[model samples]
Target: MEQTEITEILNRPYARELLGRDLTRLAYVAADGTPRAVPIAFTWNGAQIVLCTTRNSPKLPSLRRNPQVALTIDTEVHPPKILLIRGRAELDDVDGIPEEYLQMNGSYRMSAEQRVEWEAEVRSLYDGMVRIVITPTWVKLIDFETTLPSAVEELVRQRAERQNA
Candidate 1:
């Protein structure tokens, strides 16, 4: 999709709500060519979606080989709000705990002391991290208002035609 179209979709209120969320299901091609989807913490940095992983993560190799990926951020409530994105993953290896990781995880509900301890633990555990940055090539927001599922949209059209007939 065109960048302007994508920006319009992403700027919608429903899309903004989904983007505020901390988790998304990251779908990618596994090393053996199978498809895999895993829940991961992500942050939208205006232009790109950022995901952090251990430097030695197995998925890194797969991502490096095939950067194409899809991500879904959705709500569990009835008539769920979903933001779907298709993007290319770009991996960047950083020397220390990535600030993006910290920023993405900053919303976790924790006490002041717990937050400090957690940060300390994270700092000590991983020598470095890989930031998987994804710039969306296509985007969709399904809020059942301005947008609906494909089947539902078709049904709505058919119903309207019948009513007119």
Candidate 2:
């Protein structure tokens, strides 16, 4: 898709809500040439999606070998809103925990004391992390109002033709 088109979809309100969500299903090709999709915490920085993982994460090497990836952020509700994105992964080694990681998990249920304990544990456990950054090259928002599933779109077209006939 054209960059302008991608930008337009991503700028939509539904897309913005999905992007702000804590978990997105990230899909990539594994070492064995199989597709893998996993739910991960991510932060969107207007231009790119950032996910942080442990330094020795296995996914890092897979991404290094093949950076192409697809992501889906959606809601589990009637007439669900879906946002699809395609991007290339760029890895960066960061010292200490990334603030994005912490922020992404902020919505988790935790008391003030538990929150401090969790933070301390996280800080002490990991020496560094790998930042998985992706700048979206293509994007689509399926909010049912402006866009629909391919099957539904085709059905709508057929119905219109029948009515015209």
Candidate 3:
């Protein structure tokens, strides 16, 4: 998709709403040449998606081997709203805690005391974390009511043509 098209899709209210979701599924090629998808917490920084995980995360090795990835942010309700993104992952190792990691975890409903304990546990577990930044090259916004999948749209067109014939 052209940059303009992608930008327009990303700027849409529905797209922004989907992207704002705290959990998204990240899909990538594993080191063994198999496909892998995992639910992860992410934050969208206007133009890019930021995700953080431990240095020893299994997904890290796979991502390093294959930077190309796809992310799907969607709702569970009927007529779901989905934001599909394709991007290349850029890894950054940060000492101490990563701001993106904190932001990603902030969406969880936790009391002040629980939050403190959680942060302390996280800090003690890992000396550093890796930030996986993805700059989207393609973005598709699908609100089933307003926009259907391309295959479905084509099928509708075909059915209409047959009826007209």
Candidate 4:
């Protein structure tokens, strides 16, 4: 898709809302050439989606083997709002917790004491983590009001044509 098309899709209000969501499913090709999809917390930092994971995560090797990935952020509802993105993943190893990780989990209702405990646990768990940063190459936003799945849209059009005929 053209950059203009991708920008339009990503810029939609519904798409922006989805990007603000806390979780997105990241899909990538596994090292053995199979597809793998996993739910992960992420943050949209204006330019890219940033996700943090342990250095020994199973997905890391696969990502190294195949950087091309797709991300889906959607809600479970009658007419779901979905933001679909295709991107290339780049791994960045960092020494400390990334700010995005904290921001993404900030919505959770945690008491002051609970928050401290959580932070301490996180600090002790890993010495370093890998940030999987994805810069989208293509994007599509599907909100029931503005867009539907291509197959369903086609079906609706076909039915209307038959009725007219």
Candidates' C-alpha lDDT: 0.95, 0.91, 0.92, 0.90
Q: What does candidate 4's lDDT look like per residue over 45-158, in tens digits?
A: 888999999999999999998899999999988689999899999999998787777788777789989988988888898788899999999887889897988898999999
Query: How far is 115's C-alpha from truth in model 3 (Å)?
Result: 0.8
Each prediction's total of clashing residue pairs, residues at least 3 apart in sequence or on different chains, is 0, 0, 0, 0
lDDT of 2 by residue, 23-100 (tens): 999999988889999999999988899999999887878999999999999999989999989999999999999988
In terms of lDDT, which candidate is strongest?
A: 1
Candidate 3 has an lDDT of: 0.92
Rank by lDDT, highest first.
1, 3, 2, 4
Which scores greater on lDDT, model 3 or model 4?
A: 3
- The root-mean-square deviation over C-alpha atoms between each candidate and the true structure, in angstroms, is 1.1, 1.2, 0.9, 1.3
RMSD of 4: 1.3
What are the runs in model 2 whose C-alpha is more than 4 Å off? none
Q: Native-vs-model 1 lDDT?
A: 0.95
Ranked candidates (TM-score, high to low): 3, 1, 2, 4
Q: After superposition, how far is residue 147 of candidate 1 from its true place, in Å?
A: 0.7
Top candidate, metric TM-score? 3
